[model samples]
Target chain A: MKQTPRIASLPPAFGSWRDIRPLVAVVSARYRTLLQYRAAAFAGFATQLFWGAIRLMILAAFFAAATEPQPMNLTEVVAYVWLGQALLGMLPWNVDADFRQQIRDGTVAYDLLRPLDLYSYWYGRTLGFRVAAPTLRGIPMVLFAMVLLPLAGLGDWALIPPASAVAFAGFVGSLVLAAMLATAVTLLAHISLLWTISGVGVDRILTVLVTIFSGLVVPLPLFPDWLQPFLNWQPFRGLADVPYRIYSGNIPPAEIVPELVFILVWTVALVLLGRLILLRGVRRMVVQGG
Target chain B: MPQIEVRGLAKTFRVAERLPGLAGAFRGLFHRRMRDVHALDGIDFDIERGELVGYIGPNGAGKSTTIKILAGILNPTSGTCRVDGLTPWRDRRRHVSRIGVVFGQRTQLWWDLPVIESFDLLRDIYRVPPATYRDNRDRLIALMDLEPLLDVPVRQLSLGQRMRSDLAAALLHGPSLLFLDEPTIGLDAVSKLAIRDFVRELNRDRQVTVLLTTHDMDDIEALCDRVMVIGNGRILADGSVDGLRRRVRNERVLVVDYDSASEAAMLAAEGEGVRLVERDASRVRIAFDPERLPAATLIGKLLAQGTPHDLFIEHPPIEQTVAELYAEHDMRER
Candidate 1:
């Protein structure tokens, strides 16, 4: 065979610089694809806005009935609710519909033929989805809540700025870490499609679990005093509740490092666990046919 | 070493058996029944570099299973397969980086993206250098006439156009071995011919080894120098197209247009081992085993019997030959 001189002459193993190019490309390509759906973004924003208002009302009613010295004051509770609504896109509650379709239709065989690492490829792609969904829909919903809450006589329940420069940095750090952790969780759910053959059940289960344990439906601090420690110890809390708590200055300055460490540990553990599961799933798929 | 090699390569899938009714389904959940389907059973083959080999079989005859294993997407249950001295399943990343695969029924391109964008993404995925990527991309676009379709999203292109773009996408990395699984399926005649011509040229000029699996007999006849007929999870025949034709049935049909129906009938009965398979007004079709009687002798006998206005010799349809081959091996039952 006549080999292409340039290709044959190139080094067999990719350099460090070359290795990261495809990962970056995958993330950017996924982000661009999400941006192309203007109408979908608009619909998503509107839906989240409506849900944010409903959640806010429910929180307001509960706070009104509570006695003084509640675990979270009305303002902190309001911010937490709005943050949950905003970061709803970051929760890995749903697997990528395209990926699920590929699995169902058997086109995932093409994925196996590619040169990239399957886990890393999916992780990068899901990271883009997690980041893009929030940037497109959640930010608008958050901004809407900031203006709508105070006008309803909700005790100036607008978003409270971070307490310090260090706190602001911590908020950003936690949010990024949370996104990575959510991607790992989503990877695990997506890989389950290999055996389950359908993602609907997995998606529904993940949704309920995330809604309850991630503090999306209600703040973890308000999940009854007895259940607080259990909820905080779970990995689901690291996805959204920890980041929101960090952003709302709920974690005191002294304990911020430990909480951040706690989130990091969960993120690393979930990622490793996801990678291991994906390897086994891929081996089964290649050997046994999915 | 051969460019592609398979020795005792086999793949078995454990298929869960399902019951017929609701009660059986419930019982099945508690006590599942599993059956092993041997998709590929101890198949062996080798193709030298730069060879265009046709791997053909009836549906469920393990053609696709063999292709999947060779392409590095599926692992065989036992034995060994090496492509360019690399074990595909063990060294997948490096193995796949050197080969290209196209499945006619499924596309690898991003559906919502422009054709050019998918090509660019493939380039990045394969880590093709910028200069070489551009060179191959431009050459393929021109060769496949894909320039006009470059800006269109994949979902918008017609099947033929989409296939052309897919061909270009698969070759953008300058792979030395290309595995095409029904690449011309569902294409119009013009598109099919164009794709066949392009593949022929690619294999001839670039010396790229091609392993094509297609139900299209024309594709096999037009491109393959060697054809492998697989059936019942095993190879039944392997040789040139004409060699296969001779092995299956050494028969030739002679169609004679006579001046009168009586003359056609008289000629049909005059020859030995020549059976009249069909007879229409003033036209008669006679089937004769070429091994028993040469075509020239049969023509001479027809002339001796009566004067026919016109006559020509034709081989039995290749499809029928292949079908008989399949039945002889009990491919359907297996």
Candidate 2:
């Protein structure tokens, strides 16, 4: 019998560069598929705008009546709130709808046929899912809050510029890690779908936790002083609380490295957790029905 | 060494039995009941390179369990199995890279992407060299008539079209071994024939070793040189399709349609190993061992009684043959 030559001239394990091909392909494919939903981004922007208005009103009323000094002035608080609303898609509160369907149809097992490691495959692809929707909606929201608000004579209520050149650079670098942190959390939630039925239970819990702890619901500084230490120590803070504060100069340039280190540790930890669960899940997945 | 080999392979799954009703569910949450299903109970087989084989069984049988274990996606609880000299689950990344698998019940193509884009994605996924990928891809597209469907999104494809694209996706990497579980499950006759033609040519021309499991008897008869019948997690019979048929007590079914009801009534009785199966107003279906009461002799006697409008003899359907095999083996119920 004639033998076909080995199709993979570059084995994945041996060639470091060749291994990135699958990751890049997966991310690009997902990114292109998601960016097509322009209508959804528009609708999401409107919804965020309405909520941002209500949040700003509540904060202004509270700040005007305050008897004591606050950590962030109204200007800083407004910037933090607007940034959180704009980058809300980067919070990783929802599981990819694909995970639930894949598990139900037993395609998750079929996905194992590929040469790539399953956890890394999902982790890399999640970067696109985490970014594209936010990019579409975030740009519009930033324009409305930063530029349009000033022209409309609401300059005091507008999202302020970054504190300095150093702060802007730190914010840019930290934002990249924020996306990575969000991807890790998203992959963890996706892998959890293999264990749970509807995936709504864990998904809903993560939404509330992420919104509360990450300061997406309210800036972390506004939380009662007793809750500050717990919020500071948790992993969810990297999603919004830390980066947004850095951007508004609440966290100074000198502290950016330590803050970035905190986000990095969380991303590594969550990714490792996702990898362990995925490996164990596939091993015993009997996959009921056809 | 053979291209695929297994010895004393086994996999056991522990399923948690959920009780009925809200109250039962609440109690069950505290004290759970677990059942151990031995999906693959020490079954074993081997296939040399270039061999096309079929694995067939009823719905809860171990055919899929075995395929998954061999594909390296699911781990076996005990025993050893190897494909191309690598223990599948242990060396999964490399092992899976060299093999192609298609589960007939589900598609691996991205649902929202056009068929051609999905193919391109697979090329990058497997890192196939551009020249080899284009050569093999063009060949597959022509062989399967996929040019028209290339631009259509996968969700819009018919079952047969999706299956063809899936088959192409699996092969773009030029895998030497292919595993297909129920490839013809829901396909129409024309589609089934198309798939069979593609599979046969793939094995013959490319010498790609194939291990396919299906409930379709025609797929087994038309393609596999060897057939393995599984029942209750064991290999009940493994040989030629004819051997499996011979093992059944009754080898063929003869159906006769008479011009009048009296003729149908007259032929309701059987002789020796022959047994009458079913009869309607003007038709009589009989099961018999052709070796004892040859189909010709049986027909001759029927013709002597009266001229029949029509009659035909066929080997009993594979499902009946397999069910009888399970009964003969006396395998335990799940």
Best by DockQ: 1
Worst 10 residues of 1 chain B by lDDT: B264-273
Model 1 chain A worst lDDT window (10 residues) = A1-10
Q: Where does model 1 exceed 4 Å of error? A: A1-19, A146-155, A252-257, B257-311
Candidate 2 error regions (>4 Å) = A1-18, A104-106, A224-227, A277-279, A286-290, B18-26, B249-320, B330-334
Which lDDT tens digits does candidate 2 get at residues B1-334? 9988899988777778899999989989799999998888898898999999999887778998899889987777788888999988778789998999998988889888899989998998888999999999999999999999999989999999999999999999999999999999899999999999999999999999999999888899899999998888888889988888887754688889999998788864567868888888998888888778878888888888888899998777776777788878775455
Chain A TM-score from candidate 2 = 0.91
Top of the candidates by lDDT: 2
DockQ category of candidate 2? acceptable
Give candidate 2's error at residue B26 in angstroms: 4.7
Q: Which candidate leads in TM-score?
A: 1
